[model samples]
Target: MLFFSQFQTPFWFSSCFSRTIILFVFVVMCCHDDIEAALVLPNNETIPAIYVFGDSIVDPGNNNNLLTIAKGNFLPYGRDFKGGPTGRFSNGKVPSDLIVEEFGVKDLLPAYLDPKVELQDLLTGVSFASGAAGFDPLSAESANVITMSGQLDLFKECIKKIKAAVGEERTATIVSKAIYIVCTGSNDVSNTYFLLPSRRSHYDINGYSDFVAGYASQFLKDLYGLGARRIGLLGLPPIGCVPSQRTLGGGKNRDCYEAENQLASAYNAKLSGLIDDLKTVFTLPGTKLIFLDIYYPLLSLIQNPGKYGFEVATVGCCGTGLIEASIFCNPTSIPLSCPDASKYVFWDGYHPSEKAYKILTSTIINMHLKEFF
Candidate 1:
C-alpha cells in the first residue's frame, strides 16, 4: 500500500496555504492509491533503447568525474533513489531515467561516464548529458562541464564501442531504432543570457533566442547524421518561475518572473518551428523529429500545484528553496529540506521533484509515443 505523510504547515500560515495543503494530501491519498500504479507506463511500446543528451535536467551523472561544481553525487540529492545520489540532479530519477523507465526500456539509464557501465548496459542506452551543460557553448564553458559538441563526440565513441561489441548491423539497429532525447536550452536562457551579462550585451532576448535555436538545429542535424532517426527535442520550461529565478528576479515577493517566461516562450516557438522545418529538410527515409513542449505543463503545475498533488511550487524542497542547487544543495542542507518531496514540485532550486518528472514523462510518452512509429 502507498503511504503519504500528512502535510505540515506553520500555524501562522494563511488559510489558503492550509486549504492547499489539505487538498494536496487528500488528492495524493485518494488519486494516487498505489504509487507504482501511477508510474506504470500507459502503453507497451518498447524501444530498443533511449539515448539522452543535454543539461542537468536529463543528466544522470556525467558530471561526476568532471571537475565542475555542477556535480550532484552526494547525500540528500538521491535520498529516494535505490542506490544513492549517482550524480543525478534531482531527489530521485531525472527525466532521463524516467523516460527510459516509462518506455519499458530500463529502470535506470546509466551515465556513459560511469565506470561500472558495461557492454550489456551499453546495449540498452546511456546518458551523455552533463549537469549545467547547455546548447550555448558559453553556457557549458562557464560551468566547466562537457559541451554539446563534446557530448556528440562521446556519442560517436559509444557507437564505435557498440559496433565493436555487437557488429555493425546490430549497432545500426540500436542507434536508429532507439529514441534520442535532447533536453537543453534552459541554461542558455536562464544562466547564459539572463544571469551572465556576456550574451545579453551582444544579443537581446530575440537575438539570443535565434542564436540558441541555430545551435539547437545544428545539433539535431548532427544527431541525425550520426544515425539517430527518432528524436525528441525538449523545449525550455518556464524558466522564470523556478525557485532560483523567482528569488533572483521575481521582485520582493518572489513571484514568477514574466520577462524570463516570455523569453522561454519565444525560444520554444522558434524551436518548434525549427523541428517542423528539420523534418522537411532531413533526406533520411525514416527521420522523426519531435518538439516536446515542457513549458506549459510545468507552468500549469507551478501555477496550480494543488491540482497535481503538490503544495509548494514557488519554493523547492531543498535548502531555502530560493537558491540552492548542485554543490550548494548538499548534505548540510538536508535539515532544511522538506521531509516529503512528493508534495513539492521542485527537488532543488532548478530541477523538478521525482513525482513531477514522472507526471511530465508520462504525459509526453502518452501524447507522442505513436508519432515515433
Candidate 2:
C-alpha cells in the first residue's frame, strides 16, 4: 500500500494527472483569470466569461424558468449529464458543457435559473437563451415562450448582478473579453415557413425572407448595444434534411421541401452580408464579430456521411425519424427509443447525435477558432 501511494491516481493516468495538477496550481497562482474556453487548441489566453445568446443548440439552462413546450429539464434527457440534473438537452453534455471542458473548468456553467448561484457565478457569466428563439424576437413568442428580446431583458438583470459582484469597470472588461456564441434559426425555419400554416398562406416566399433578414439585422445591433465584443453567430443548418421535416413534408422520397431550405440558405446569406456591413455600421475595432457557417458545415456532413463515418444520415437514431422525436423526447410519458442510436446522425428528429456533436465541435476548434479567438 505504501509503495503504491504515488501511483494512486491510477497507473494509466498518474503521471499526466500529477503534471496537470502542478500546471493548474502554477497558473492559478499567477494568472489574472481563466474562463471556460470554447477552443481545444493550445491558446492559453484567458478571458473573463462566455455570454451566450440564441436558442437550444447552445443554451445551458435558460428554459428552466420558461413555460415553453421546447424544454428539456426532465427524464432520459439528463441521463448522461452525470449523477445530477442540469437541464441540458443532450443526455449528458451539450456544446456549452464541452466548451467549459475545453477551458479546463469542469464545473457546469451556472444555469441562469439555478437559485443556488451567487454573485461570483454571475461574474463568470450565464446563458439567457431560450430553446426556440433566434434573430426573431417573435420566434419564441410564436411557441408561447421566451424570445431573443426577452433573453436580453434577463441579461439586463444578469448584468446588474455582475456589476455588483465585479464592479462596473471590471464587468465591462469581462463582457468585452468574453466570447458570445449565438446559435439559432433552425426552429424559426422549422416552425414558421414549413410548419405554421399562417405564415405559408399569408406571405409569399420573398416577403417572409425579407422579414427574417430585417429582424436578424436588428438582433445584431441589440447585442452590440449590450457590450458584446467578440461574437460568433451560427446560421441554420439544412432544415429540409432534419428527420422530422423530411418525414412530415414528403416522407423522404426525394420530394424535399426545397422552399424552406432555400429560405434558410437565403437568410444565412443575408446574415453573412449583414456581418460584413457591421464593420462600417457598428465601428467595432479591436474585438472580432464573426459568423460560423454551421449550415454549410452540417450540409457537407449530411451530403458525404461516409467521410464523417456515418452509415445512415437520412433518418434519425430514434425509432422511425418521423414521430421518433415525440417518442424519445419524453420517455416517461412516451416510450424509450431504439437500441441502435449510434447508427443515425440525429439523436431525435431535430438534434444531432453524440458522434455528430463531437465532429462539429472538433471542426470548430481545429478549423474556425483562429478567426474568432
Candidate 3:
C-alpha cells in the first residue's frame, strides 16, 4: 500500500485501486531478484571499481602528459593495445589492464590523467600510477613523475568530486569496496638505490630495505585512512633479471645479478612481515591487506622459458632488447618489433611483454581470488 501511495489517485477510487496496489506490491516484493538483476552491480556483487597505484608496472598513460623521461607515448610501445602508445611501458596492456578485465566491467583501466575521464569512470576506477614513481620521493623526483603521496592526493581530490556527484555515503562505499593495488618498490631498489650512489653511500642493503618498507607502511596507512579496505600490495619482482638491468651489467654475456635479486627477496620478506604487522596493529575491522607474490611465477618463467612456451625470456621485444626503453624504444631507431611478442618475456627493457603480464596477473588473481574478489 505504501508503494502504491506513490501513484496519484483519488481517495474515492482507493477501493477500485486496491486490487491494482496489491498486484503492484506483489510484483515489487516477490520479483526482487529480477529487480536486482536489472540494477547491474547490485549490492556490489561484482567489484564496483578497481583503483590502481604504482610505477610503470601498472601505469597506463599517466606519464604521457607529465614532464618525465618515463613517458611511453610513442610507437612500438602500445603496438598491441587498443590505441597505440598509451604510455604503458609494455608493448601492449600492462598487468593492471588485464587484471581489470577479470572484474568484468571495463576492458581496460584508463589513466587518471586522461582529460576525458568522467564522473562515471571515477565511480568505476582509475589508475594514478606514473611510469617511474616509487615509494621514495627521491625516486619519483629523479624520474620527474608523481610520487606515491601525490597519487594519494589525486585520489583524495577524486573522492571529493565523487562525493559532490553522488553524495558522501555512496562515495564512501565505492572507495571502501574498490580494490586498491600498489605495484611499486621496484623503482626504489632498481632506480633509486642501485642506480644512484648517494643512497648506497648512506645505507647498506639491509638499512635500505627497512627504509623502503617504512615508507610502504605509511603509504598503506594513509590509504586505509582514506577508507580503502581491500588492498593488494604487489611484491617486488626479480628486478636484477630484467633485460635493462642485465644489459647494464654487460649486455649479452652477463648473468642475472644475484646481489640485486637478494635485495629484492629481502625487501619482499620485510614487506610481507609489514603487512602482517599492519593487519594486527590497525583497528580496521573489515580491512583485507593482501601480499601478492609475483616472484616465483616470474622466476619460473625466466628460468625455464620453454616450460612456459616462451622462446625468449632473456630479451625484450623492443630495440635490441638490452637497455632500450621509453624514448629509446621508438620505431625509427629500433625498426619493427618481433613478429611474435608472446615469445619474449620483457617488452622493452624494464617491463614485461603483454603475454607475460597476462600470465602473471592470472596467477596472482587465481592465488588471491578469496582475499580480493
lDDT of 2: 0.59
Local distance difference test, per candidate? 0.75, 0.59, 0.72
Query: What TM-score number comes out for model 1?
Result: 0.89
**Tens-digit lDDT track for model 3 on 280-317?**
97754566787877777687778988766678988788
Q: By descending TM-score, how would the candidates be arranged?
A: 1, 3, 2
Global Cα lDDT for candidate 1: 0.75
Per-candidate RMSD, Å: 9.9, 10.6, 13.6
Q: Candidate 1 residues 1-373, lDDT tens each?
A: 0000000000000011111212111111235521221322223333677787888877878889888898889988999999988998888877777656644567888999999999888888998987777778998899999989999999999999999999999999888777787888777777778878878899888898899889999999899889888887777888888898899899999998888889888888998899989878886666778777677777787888887788899999998898998898999999999999999988888888888876666555544554554
1 or 3, greater by TM-score: 1
Backbone clashes, candidate 3: 0
Quote the lDDT for 178 in model 3: 80
Q: Best by TM-score, which number?
A: 1
- Using lDDT as the yardstick, the better of models 1 and 3 is 1
Cα displacement (angstroms), candidate 2, residue 94, comes to 1.5
Off-target runs (Cα >4 Å) in candidate 2 are 1-44, 105-107, 252-256, 326-328, 332-336
